[model samples]
Target chain A: MISIHNLTKQFGRLRALDGIEAEFSAGQSIALIGPNGSGKTTLLKCLLGMARPDNGTLQFEGSDLTRSDTYRARIGYMPQIGRYPDNMRIGQLFDMMRDLRGYPENVDEELLDEFGLKAMFDKPLRALSGGTRQKVSAALAFLFRPAVLILDEPTAGLDPLAAEVLKAKILRERNTDRVIIVTSHILSDLDEISTHVLYLMDGKLQFFKDIETLKTETGESRLGLAIANVMRRHANENQASA
Target chain B: MLAKYSSTAAATLPFTGEPDGVTCAEKKARPVAAMLKIAKYVLYDILRNRIVLGYAAFLFVAALTFFNLEGDGSKSLMSLLNIVLIVAPLVSVIFSTIHFYNSYEFIELLVAQPVSRRTILGAEYAGVGGALVAAFLFGIGLPVAVFAPDARGFTLLVVGVLLTLVFVSLAFLAAVLTRDKARGIGLALLLWFCFSILYDGLVLVLLFAFSDYPLEKPTLVLTFLNPVDLSRILMLLQLDVSALMGYTGAVFNEFLGSTLGVALAYGCLALWVLLPMIWAERVFRKKDL
Candidate 1:
């Protein structure tokens, strides 16, 4: 479980994440959605401790995120674009990650097998295509069977079939006692995987609601259409205020 | 079987289900070991790098050529000294800057892991610094030892090692200061140019501008400021080439020729290797990936 309160981050003149407050508990698959420069990535960076906040407290499992790195052991993160050492082989990369995580024996190799990555064990990371790299990122994110999984654009570069496989994997993981947070521009890809939709606009939290509630409130059956209606309403309100 | 057992074990745990069940104390004790693991991977990556290998090969061949050209061992050492002073630092700073920028995304990935920022940066420094030190040792130190195994030769090797480390630290500082790769590399090159070239010119202009003033103590202080110059002075003094350096050389000999002066010079060089790394680590800790 993660709790964020009044989180603020500034990049010179740009206030990337401003006064963000949210709570994510176990078994909740949150879809973090925002427009470009809406601070989605900044919030994720703050949660992961990659970027320090100007003001706020981030607590993981009731402990401050800044207190120690042991909290991160429970969080498995996959970057939007996975960049690995160019010279390292796929097997070596996985091995190195295992070694860093202290060689967890009960590793999840489902994604690895589903993506057929074991066959390309000797292939260097640089030689892999973007889709394959996405697969590797996906596999690594799930490898440790962590308590929390933060996946950024998990299905971006994946093919339709691979994306479906990943969506199915997310659905299966959702049944477990785990917390999953995902951010993607592809709303449809997140439609079935996410239970809650967290929308951000201009570094401000516009709404955080369950998908069913959002659908009912907006009177739209589809997640994408529902979000579009909300965004339109917000834009009209902003224009009227201006 | 192990996966099933671990899953059941995790479910039995009280509050949070840590699959691996790594305790807080175990986690705290693993930072050093984790840093070394990361360093090992980085070292392996760098070892397989064609450019670094080429750099090492270039030094080895160049040193061999110098020894072949100059039949006199000291003369060859002098030639190799120039190479070590200029080319070694240039290669080290540029290589380190480029490596840091290239590994930027990978570092972001690492940041999201359980390791602390301090461990990641320290591992990076150790990996890159260690690789370059190895390159210099095998490249230049090996040939020098083979040809001229004297005290002067050993001093050259020491100077080469220190300059490599100092430049690596400077390059890391430059890399952490700017997010852009081009700007970081440019800053690194500027640092190399300032210490290796411009600093000496500025010192010469100062010496000429105030020729009337007592300048020996000031010059000695100035020499400690640049690692490259300090190394050159150390090597030159060790070679006993003060006769060619005139009055200022004798003054340098009077000071640097003493035991305490040599110790102080080495101490300053060690500081050169440390201060920049510590400063860079501070910047990296608070840096936005």
Candidate 2:
């Protein structure tokens, strides 16, 4: 579980995350959707301690994550664009991550096997295509069976079959009550896995609602159309005064 | 089998279902292990780089050529000093800067790991600093040790190592300051240029402008300011070339002629390495990946 309070981050004159307050609980499969430059990645980075917020606090299970590294052990994060050491082989990279985590007692390798990363052990990360790299990222995220999973665009670069496998894994984890936060642009990709939706626009939390609640309220069954209708209303309201 | 056991345990134990991170906290990854692991990877990556290999080869050839060209070993040591002064810092600074910028993705991935930010940064500094030092020692120091085994040769080696550390630390600082890779590299080169070239030119002007006054203290201060100048003075003293050093060298000789002065010179060199290191660590702690 993670709790954020009044979180704010700014890059030069541009504010990336503004006064964000949110919570993530176990068993909640959250789909974090936002337009470009709306601070989705930045928010995820702040949570992972890659980006430090200017104001407010983020805690894992009531203790400040910024204060300790041990708290991070429970989190498995997948960056939208996974960047690894170019020269390192995929096998060595996995070995190093496992070594860094101190050889956890149990590591879930479903995605790793399903994605067939084991066969590409000799391939250097530089030689791997973008989709292959995404497969690697997805595998690592699920490797630990982490209490919290922060996945940024987890399926963006995966093949259709690989994407389906990942979706199935997400659904299985949701039933097991593991916390998985995903940020994705593809509505259909999210519709099956995510139970809740948190939409962000211009660094603000436009709304947070259950997927079914959102669909029912918007009078649209499709997640993408429901979200579009909501955005359309927001745009119309803002444009009316302008 | 292990997965099945874990699944069964999770199902049977209500405590495992609790959201508290402390209950089933991972075996903490020791900071030392984290640091060493990262350093190991960084060293492996750098050693294989064509640039680092080229750098080491260049040093070997330069040292070999100079040693053979000058019939007398001491004469060659003098030439080696100048070369080491110019080449070591240039190569170390630029190489470290580029390595830091190029490893951006690696750094990002590491940042999200369970390891602490301190471990991440400490490991990075150790990694880069260690790799470049290795390059310098093998490429440059080995030849010097073989050719000139005296204290003077050893002094040159120490100076070379110190310069490498100083420049690498400065590169870390430069990399941390700006987000753009090109700008960061530019800033690093500019820093190298200022210390190696511009700093010397300005010091010369200051010495000339105040030629009439007793500039001993000021010149001494000035020499102490730039690491390159300090290194030059140390090298000159060791090579027994006080006559070519002119007035400032004499001033340095008077001050650094004693054991205390020698200690102070090394202390300053160590400080040069330390100041940038501390600055870089501070920047790294707060740096956005």
Candidate 3:
């Protein structure tokens, strides 16, 4: 479980994450939805301690996130664009990660088998296609059987079947005491796996609610339409206030 | 609870042979062990790079050509010294800057893991610096040992190795100071230029402008400021070329030519290697990857 308080990150004049606050508890698959440049990635980066927050505190399991990196042992992150050493083989990359994590025998490898990545284990990372690279990232994220999985645009470049495979894996993994935070533009994909929705607009938290409550309030069964309905209401409210 | 879920899923989907004993608590090695692990991978990557291999081959051939053409050990050493002073630092700077930029995404990936920033940057410094040092030793050191094998030849090899590390550190500093690849590389080149060429030009102007005064100490301090100059002076003193350098040369020969002076010069070069890397590490720790 993680808690963020008054998280603010400023990039020059643009406020990427403006005094945002949220809490994510275990067994909650959070769908972090936001438009482009809406501080979605920045928020995730702050949580991962990849980007230092201009002002705020992040706590994981009652411990300060920025104080030590041992907390990351529980986190498995799949970057939006996974960049790897060009000449390293897929197998070598996985081997190196396993070695670094010191968990050679405890890896999941479910996504690896499902995606059939083992067949191309010898191929250099630079030779992999975009979808294949996505598969690699997904597999690595799930490899450690981590308590928290932060995936950024995980299904963006996947094929339909691969996307379905990843979704099914997410669903299966969600049953455990794990917190899966996924950021993707595809609402239907999230609808299948996510239990909670955390929406952001202009670096501010628009809402953080359960999917059922969001559905009932918007009177829309599908998440895409429900979020669209909420956006429309917000836009009208803003215009009237102005 | 995790085992129960995995077992339930296992009934439908075949499980990989891994046991159902996955725990949230991870076992990690000590910081140095982790640093070495990352450094090993980085070293392997650099050793396999075509550009780096080509650089090694180029140095070997250049050393061989110089030795064969000169036919005299000291003359060949002087030629190789120029290569060490100019070409070695340039290659180290450019290659290291490019390598850092190319591995930007890889660094991001590593940062997301359980590793500390110190481990990542330290591994980079060790790996790149190690590979370049090995290349210099292999390409130039081997030939000099075979053809000359004198104290001056030995000093040349030491200077070459230290210069490589010094420039690599400078390159990392440049890379960390900027987000843009072009800018990083430009800054690296500018640093190389300042140390190798501009610094010498400024020293010459100072010597001419201060010809009326006893400028030996200031010029000696200026030489220590530039690793390239420190290396050249270190090697030239060993080559016994102070007679060609005039009165200041006699001063340098008297000062840098002694045991304490040599130790001080090497210490200055070592500082050149450490200071930039330490500064770069500080910048990289809080850097937004």
Best by TM-score: 3
TM-score of candidate 3 chain B vs. the reference:
0.89
**Model 1 per-residue lDDT tens digits across residues B264-286:** 99999999999999999889988
TM-score winner between 2 and 3, please give it. 3
lDDT of 2 by residue, A72-154 (tens): 56678888888899999999999988877666667888887888899999999999999999999989987877788888999
TM-scores of chain A across candidates: 0.97, 0.96, 0.98
Those runs of model 2 whose alpha carbons end farther than 4 Å from true positions after fitting are A236-242, B1-29
Q: After superposition, how far is residue B204 of candidate 3 from its true place, in Å?
A: 1.6
User: DockQ of candidates 1 onward, in order?
Assistant: 0.46, 0.45, 0.40
Q: Tens-digit lDDT track for model 1 on A174-209?
A: 855788999999998788899999999889999999
Off by over 4 Å in 1: A239-242, B1-29
- Tell me how far the alpha carbon of residue A90 in candidate 3 is from the true structure, in angstroms, after superposition: 1.4
TM-score each candidate. Answer: 0.91, 0.91, 0.92
| Residue range B181-246, candidate 3, lDDT tens digits | 999999999999998889889988988998899898898888888899889888888888768999
Question: lDDT of model 1 at residue A189?
Answer: 79
